[model samples]
Target: MGNRVFVVGVGMTKFEKPGAREWDYPDMAREAGTKALEDAGIDYRQVEQAYVGYVYGESTSGQRAVYELGLTGIPIVNVNNNCSTGSTALYLATQAVKSGQADCTLALGFEKMQAGSLGTIYDDREQPMMRHLLALAELQEFAMPPAPYMFGAAGKEHMERYGTTEEQFAKIGVKNHKHSLNNPYAQFQDEYTLEEILASKRIYGPLTKLQCSPTSDGSGAVIVASEAFVDKHGLADQAVEIVGQAMVTDMESTFADRSAISLVGADMTRVAARKVYEQAGISATDVDVIELHDCFSTNELLTYEALGLCPEGDGGKLVDAGATTYGGQWVVNPSGGLISKGHPLGATGLAQCSELTWQLRGTADARQVSAAATTSGVALQHNIGLGGAVVVTAYRPANR
Candidate 1:
């Protein structure tokens, strides 16, 4: 890396259910991109490149989105990494600055998804998740949506191995929903009691409808710059440094073992998080706030162990002890997470970035993590895709 990359600004739109609004992806993109630029106090002409992420779109959707900012003629690269697409775009933008390819780059992601459980758009082509489906069949089978079963099976395995309970998983939904009450951008902000969560219609295994992320339409963006660019623009007061970031894909362990936990990306998350800790010279205990992928409450629980927030298979105990919330070890998902905040596949990761940046800047007024706000604290992020990929990143305010 030739230069240290810092995020100078971040922005996102309120996450809404699919087709709930009149706006299209381009409109969403423009709203988010403009906010990021405005936050950075820069013009589109200053941006040297763009990396846009989306899963369902026509060719050059990135180009169309960028045009909403300006036809600056900078190179625009489109990225698709399943659910990890947003963070993958962020990774590319950070690299473009770190490698001295550009002083400033924009990472933007948006999605306009269809209602209901996700389905294949290209049924005639080779499906990327076929192998994953095969692995699922080996473990347990379900008649409902494929995603819930994958993560739900992981939760079931954790229960069998470590005595985790259905109530424990339901608590995650309760917590996130409570947190979302403070986030205006979240799609679902109504808090539910544990009993309500448990009583909601079951999707798969112990998972309930309240425990899963809904199909969402939204956009988020971040403006990243090199140290030199920040200095030149006098943006030192607001810059957040990317202390460390790492991405990992599936390994032999994903398939070699029949465990549903590993099959649903536990190993990949563990590896990526370890790499991030190594790069940042920090431990899981150092993190004060987290915005992890909570596509399902089960995944959130699985991730606690994967990220070493607790001993392996003790994720249920971790949450039950109040260790993953505001007054505990860390404030996980102060933004309400995917379960309550909504998961726009292409935009979820950047939304995490946006929330963390605000928290670091002491601007997350309603949902601020108190201890983290009081000190020079670390924020941890985890975004995963099941085909599979995981990105773990560490952030700190630049002055810290």
Candidate 2:
């Protein structure tokens, strides 16, 4: 791999249906890819590799969108890692540029599930081995199936194991929504409170509907360049470098073996972040803004400890102290996260990259920070795949 890879540009559409009608994959891909190209001040001709992530775009996936940029047979690749699809593409793009395989690469992720159904979730009997295991568990535990709501059970287990409360989970909601209020592209731009969150209808145990990320369909893209390429193109003067990256996969069958809330591959998040920080010679306290994978409100809490932002069981403390807020010492999820910003499956990771790119570039408009801006300020993103596959990354300004 090359010495370094940098994010030259990033783009994302509003985290909602584009018009009166809902959204479709092709349109969103075009919207996001064009925006990224514009932001990078470069033409699609510069992109040598394209990695498009989509969950259910059906026929003609990544290639169709890159074709929007005047197809030049740019070795396009498609990736689908459940919810972590976008991040997977991003990881690959970075590797491509780092390995000298491509000087410039594009990673785009988009989806269109707002129209109605969830598009297409393979329910075939001839699925992976993990499918059979989960099915048997569901048959045994009839009432409480281990689906996306496992996060809720994890929340309950957190409280049971560490005396955390529903109100504390609500605290994370209040903080993130407040941060979202400043993000123009965020879906829900308002401040919520613990009381209000508790008052809302419950989805699973203590998890209210508002606390859960809705099934949002959206699109986002990120452009990466090699350090040599950036220097040649004068892009290093304005780019976000990748300081760290790490991906870990755990046992997919999360039935009786693992604890629901005991931190799934959490050690991986820390290890990855630490590696980047050590390589870049920076610490967690050095980061001024962040985009976290908050598919469930409970996740935000766990990430704090996992990322070493705060001590274990101190997630509530970090949020309550106003540390994760904009004016606070360090900001987390200024983009509203999957909770308020909308989780467009494959697009989530790219969205995080877009947000951090804007932030480090000091182009965040209303949400910009005035901190001791590391010309290469850090932007961390975490994305988890089916059950437990996760990939976390940290980005810095390309120039730096």
Candidate 3:
């Protein structure tokens, strides 16, 4: 690390179904961005650079969103990387601070999706995911959304290989739904029984409607500053340091293996997570809280092995042993995760960063992880975009 960087504040709007609220993307961005600035006790003029993430927007949307904060002449970069867009923005912001290029930087992400599952918007242009789709096509095809089919096939393979059951996957939905009940910002607060989760209308393979993330409209932002900036501003008590982060793209294994698990970018997640662990000088066991990408329930279980949370092919047994929920070995998705918190394309990753920051600050209240509630607090975040990229980050309280 060149210069230590810390997140002094974070904020996000409560996610809602597309068109469920009367707000536009700019409106969401304003609300979330202003809140983060206020939380940091700074004005927009203090921000020297900004990275805004989104997928379904036109050019300069990042500049437009930051204009809501102030018409400061800051450099605003627009980023798009599928589901990992938000974390990509956050990664850039952290780098700006750590490289001593900027004292204060903002990472913002928002999306306003249309109703229903995601679909192609620009058929005329080259699709970024075309190759990933082709790789997916090499496997058994299904008459469903590409996302569900890709991840579902992975789940099917995991079941075939490791004896994982449908119920085992459904249990993740149950646990996350239950966790969402206590999160005010979650899109779905109503808890569901494991039976109900299993009984819900199936989307693909073993995944039900409850297990898949819905299209959502929302925004999330974080304010990162150098340690010198944090201390100068007397923000130590509320600061959270980003210890390590890494981003990786799909390797030849992603397509060469002809495995749905690899095609869906599990290998990318594994590689990025491993790099972050090594850079942070810590292991998965040291993490007290996690906010891994759970765009679908199958991906969550697939990620457990990739992130080294459990032995390969042991994710089902890990859940059965209750090692990934409150009062367990680690509290995963205490903010309800994308399964309940909603996936607003761009906002998802920064929202995860916000949740982990709150956890590290011991301010998550009812959803507080056991480690934060009683002992040292450490957080690990994993975000992925299937065309394909993965970002893994580690965080801890600055005062620690």
Judged by TM-score, which candidate is best? Answer: 1
Please give, for residues 315-385, the per-residue lDDT of candidate 1 as tens digits: 88898899988889899999999999999989999999999999988899999987666447799999999
Q: TM-scores across all candidates?
A: 0.99, 0.90, 0.98
Candidate numbers sorted by TM-score from highest down: 1, 3, 2
| lDDT winner | 1
What's the lDDT for candidate 3?
A: 0.91
Q: Worst ten-residue run, lDDT, model 2?
A: 139-148
Residue-wise C-alpha lDDT for candidate 3, range 1-400, written one tens digit per residue: 4998899989999999888999888899999999999989998889999999999999999888888889978889999999999999999999999988999999999999998988997789988777877777767775468888888889999999899999999999998889999999999999999889999999888899999988899999999999999989999999998988999998999989989899898899889888988988899999999999999999999999999999899999999999999879988899999999899999999999999988888788899875863336789999999887899999988887
Q: If both were scored by lDDT, which would come out higher, candidate 1 or candidate 3?
A: 1
Better of 2 and 3 by lDDT: 3
What tens digits encode model 2's per-residue C-alpha lDDT throughout 1-400?
Answer: 3568888888888887434345567788888999999888999988999999987666658887667666787788988887888999999999998888889999999876644323335777554435533543343332232333556766766677777778878877877777788887777787877788889887775688778777776789999988788888888766888878877765443444455553344555656667767766777887778788888788778777778788877777776787887678778887788888888888999998888888888888777765525664677777876545678887777656
Identify the runs in model 1 with alpha carbons over 4 angstroms from their true place.
Answer: none
Clashing pairs in 2: 2-98, 236-399, 239-397, 239-398, 240-396, 240-398, 241-396, 241-397
